[model samples]
Target: MTTQHLEHPTHTHTHGPDCGHQAVSHGDHVDYAHDGHLHREHSGHWDECESGAHTTHDGHTHVHGSDCGHEAVRHGDHVDYVHDGHRHAEHDGHYDDH
Candidate 1:
């Protein structure tokens, strides 16, 4: 997986345990959910958490798409389906955490 390389410009608010935004674990880092998107602290700056490892959601038989009964969020290059308490994105014939 690769990072988007897109920095969130003029980001003044620091996200953390008490930042009010929901914290989601992404691979080896923590990303904060804010403004309908995910943000990660990187190199003293903030970037949209858009890329990561292709972790397959085993036993996930439900296909996510239009009218899939889940909230579809427009991500950088693809759509993520909100299920349970996390987001899932389709990649390489499986769903990965977004």
Candidate 2:
């Protein structure tokens, strides 16, 4: 949601310990404060909704009770689309096995 460009181009800035979102890293490691924790997208083994895995993020993949229409969900961390029931998961152009 917030992007802070560091001094160095390659030096990517993290959301720090302020916001409760995932921190994206390009190369450089910048310090930030978002509450008290840092979030980063999952590595290559990541999965998300697009992948169709519907990872067990909140323990619920598809509609919990009714047609929630989870067409596109998720805040971060597991942005990678899981094939379990999700739609897609892409990292650096790497897509999910689904």
Superposed on all Cα atoms, the candidates' RMSDs to the truth, in angstroms, are: 4.6, 12.5
Candidate 2 ranges beyond 4 A from true positions: 1-70, 75-84
Per-model TM values vs. the true structure:
0.61, 0.19
Candidate 1 global Cα RMSD: 4.6
lDDT of 1 by residue, 36-62 (tens): 777899999998887545656778888
Worst 10 residues of 1 by lDDT: 50-59
Query: Which candidate gets the maximum lDDT versus the true structure?
Result: 1
Q: Report lDDT (CA) for all predictions.
A: 0.78, 0.31
